[model samples]
Target: MTERKEINVLNENVARIEQEQPIGISVLGPGAADWEFWLTSAGFKLANQEDADVILWVDPEAKDFPAIAKDPRCIVVGNSKTNALCQQKKITYVKDVNDGEGIQRQLEEFGRKTRETLENPTLAKSRSLTVPPALSPQRPEKKHGIRLQRGLIKRHLPPDAPLEDPKGELREEFREESGPLSRRKDIIAALPSLGEDERRLKQYIQEKSEGEYRVLEVAESYADLIRAAEKGFFEVILVHRELPGLERNLVENLKLLREKAPGTRIILIERQSDDFSAMYKGHLDVIDLEWQVIPELPGHLVSLLKGQYERQPENHVVFKWEDERKPVTSLPSVRTSVLSPALIAYHSAGGGVGKSTGATQMGFVFAEMGYKTLIIELDTEKPSLLRAVGAAEDCPGLAAWNHSDFISERTAIEAIRRTSRQVHGLYVLPVGPISPKKVVLPFHLEGLNGGEEENVDPCQQAAVFYSAALKEFQIVIVDTNNSCVDPPVFMALKMAKRVFYVMEATKVFLDSAEAHIEQAYDLGIQLSNYRIILNKCTANDLLSLRTITQTLEIPVSLQVPLDVEGYRLAAHQGKPYKPKTKKGISPWGEFCQNVLQDLEVPITTSQAKKPSLRNWLLGWKKKS
Candidate 1:
């Protein structure tokens, strides 16, 4: 009997080496999917055929070869006899496609050859397998080769000099260095502590430039930081992202620093694990250094001072219109229009569950009950709200948010009022018309154009939107991202008064739900705020309601049955599921009603009567 083996086990050494120097391989045709997990685990990036360092031809017996396969960099992996018969050279033959270890060894060897070929052409040419011709001749790109003309250089005095005032003559000769004093690039650092690490940083800088270029001061408090900034003409101000008091509002402090030190460049220093980029990364520089690599901070500062460091590219938002109108400086206080409006967020562990469906249906029911409701789409990855409502994706929605950092409560309400489409009486704030990949939440617009005020903190923006939304509507349903906990979803969880943890009534999804619920709690969301909503419950499902509730260790708030036909019918109409008769309510509606009663949400009478039979059938009535 043959021993069973786990496929695609990660090779740590290979993964580490690949991380240091990635190998871009393009796996072509048919069986490409088979190698994806293995390649990804081994830290190999899948690139396009044209840009790939190596081309992998999955189809062994293919007569018609892709144009890229003709390159010397292409490696054919298949049957030796078949490859030989096909007249291909430099083939890697693996007995079984499932043998991930064998494939890893071969690819590692090929990557070494590719690296050597680029490093030394003579060494690469002696080997049977060679890298692509284009990459083979060129050396690796220089990271820190360019050095700016900085600091001072001691000059060798000429043998002969003027007879009169030699010291004066020498002083006149080297006047350029003496004039303006050529300041030694002072720096002010504001870190969480001014302990041994801080002293060591100062010592390192002094040693690097002989005490000339060094940290002039270190601030331990927000007050000290602002004072340091205002007092010094420092070239660089390095502030910790999570500096004690600065955590409350980092951007506000950053702006203060920018104002205090006009020409000084501010750089935010953070721990490697921290990601403040999803928050405030506008026009400022940020560096994420490992805690162990704190000693290297001096070197990085020296490079910055020398103007040789390659800083991260700044994200610039270019507006479509040439209007030079300044953005809203600050958000206005939200006047209490509706007393404590219900803020509900719907989330799930994985996609393909009825998370969005549940949110929309609940919002629809609220709207029908004479409560003004707004369903905010927070699923940036793949927003389905617009499509679900039969509205054009190009309609103004989240795109309006790109305008300013501090959006007014009125502006938020106005943007939704003007851009949003209403179905029955439910208002939907749609995701903008663009590829989800290019869409950045909180801030950071990739290809989109806007004003200078871009990339505000996700939490800040969400707060702005939420406060604004609450002022206009009695019920705000936030349809969050499915599966992963992104920044938007995190903010949604924090902001929501009630969280609906939606999941399918299946073992696989139930397990996922348990994991996600734990994760939500780990992220500091209150367990008491969450309620499990079991969706797609079938009549003969293996697990009963009692079994599911017991398995998850949480009470199931609602168990929505599998209603594919009803969903399809609703989707076809670009609306939520409705009742068959005027006096009756759908199952989803009943679920919403029960939820409202449980939450103590007031249900008022609808202002408008049912549409005329002619209008209902023909849709002759115009939208309000």
Candidate 2:
């Protein structure tokens, strides 16, 4: 029995090595399912069929094959509905690679040469099969393996799907979260031994990463590790190589992470005196004690991690209209072209005339064209500009400890994100998450009370939020939803360098416009800072727009033709519509640009401000 088992194992290995050839093999349709299962189950390399000696076409119904002719290795298997796709190619037949006795029988009959016989291996070899006698159950139990016995797994496949055979869950799990459950076993099993051997290493790191830089405990699983790397989580990622179960899948997954998330830095885990030459190809930070003269791996790790901890991609807006693109918001902000320190105010009398949309267009364009712009969403009601720019993630809000004063400024700036990548140089950070709307108070806690005053408070807080964000930005656009209760909204209106009152050209819109204008006027807001933006306006409604602006103290800033296609596409895909041409473009952007030009903010690079990453990281690092 032992000799037979040894010969069988040798035969299987020889068959695999001899038959296998370098190639990129893709088993689309039903075959992908089996390919993944078999490859993963057997720890096989998924060689590309393009460089292979064979193309194993598995499905029966795919389209006719493209060009190419007779080849010995093109084997089509199974009673597939996909054979039509291979009509143009030189086809051979293999009922199945996994077909039982038939495969061995055919190979034997053909007298296929064994590539080589492995008589000796370095492994601590043992052929010990222990079969435990079945113990009678204390009680006769109903079968719980009904699902597996019935072959119910295939029932989960999607209807008529592509690549359904190798549904990528195992491969995806492998690619996504460092691959399948088996790989998880490899990573964890590798750690227990390493920890047992490396005590001084951990202690050394603790000593070096002293002060504000301290080690945040080690990550155990791929998920826990990833969770640490997420926004506002732990900072450094350290890896150790003593893990024996490392697989190609693990390495590939890490590579995927590097591309999708470029900010993360990975530390190679190696012992203090291990040879470094073998690991250098990974192309990441190597903290091996074997090659370095540094003391205490833990302390050195702490030092390296201190510099890289807590990194978020600098908020940058890309402006790309079709092909031409560049970072626009980083540009030096001119005073409305020369209005210095002007407050941008927005207001509406009734709800929804594109106030948010107008704000988004202006804010994004200003940010894109090289002005440090922050568009603040102040409306807590129904959908507003936050939704348009995809900024209103949760009720378009900032997560405040309280409204009294935003707990010291860090909370607001840290919450911003570039909402959409519209062009070469544009970004959007949506409004704060709004869940279950109202800010509630506990019955016993009397320090904070729930009241109608909450409505006006957020509006008041917008200025504070805007001012703080502007410290790092050049232009800030504040969009306030029309609220009757808030006196602070009026104060915000009065403080504007320019305000866009977006309205339709209809009589109802005009009426709404008048009411909004009056509200701001009552608040003592300088009517001059406000401008009329006629959104969705037609050539026919030009008269009403002019009349409304003229009657009010405000002037018509822009009569924007309705651009539904680009804007709608942007919202749907979570992207932005990059506008073409500088003049008479988006109502907000063109208006904001005009405001900057009027304020004398420099437009061209000859007068543009220099790029500054110096503001982001080290004030005086060696690299700087």
Pick out the ten consecutive residues of candidate 1 with the lowest summed lDDT: 1-10
Local accuracy of candidate 1 as per-residue lDDT tens digits, 158-234: 32333124343322223222211133455677766534455456655556554345565566656556755543245
Candidate 2 per-residue C-alpha lDDT over 417-464 given as tens digits, one digit per residue, 9 for 90 to 100: 212111212233333443545432111123445564344445445555
As a TM-score, model 1 comes out at 0.42
How far does residue 129 in candidate 2 sit from its true spot (Å)? Answer: 20
How many clashes in each candidate? 1, 85
Which candidate number has the best TM-score? 2
lDDT of 2: 0.41
* TM-score for each candidate, following the candidate numbering: 0.42, 0.45
Q: List lDDT for all candidates, in order.
A: 0.57, 0.41
- Candidate 1's C-alpha runs over 4 A off are 1-336, 403-411, 434-438, 442-455, 579-585, 607-624
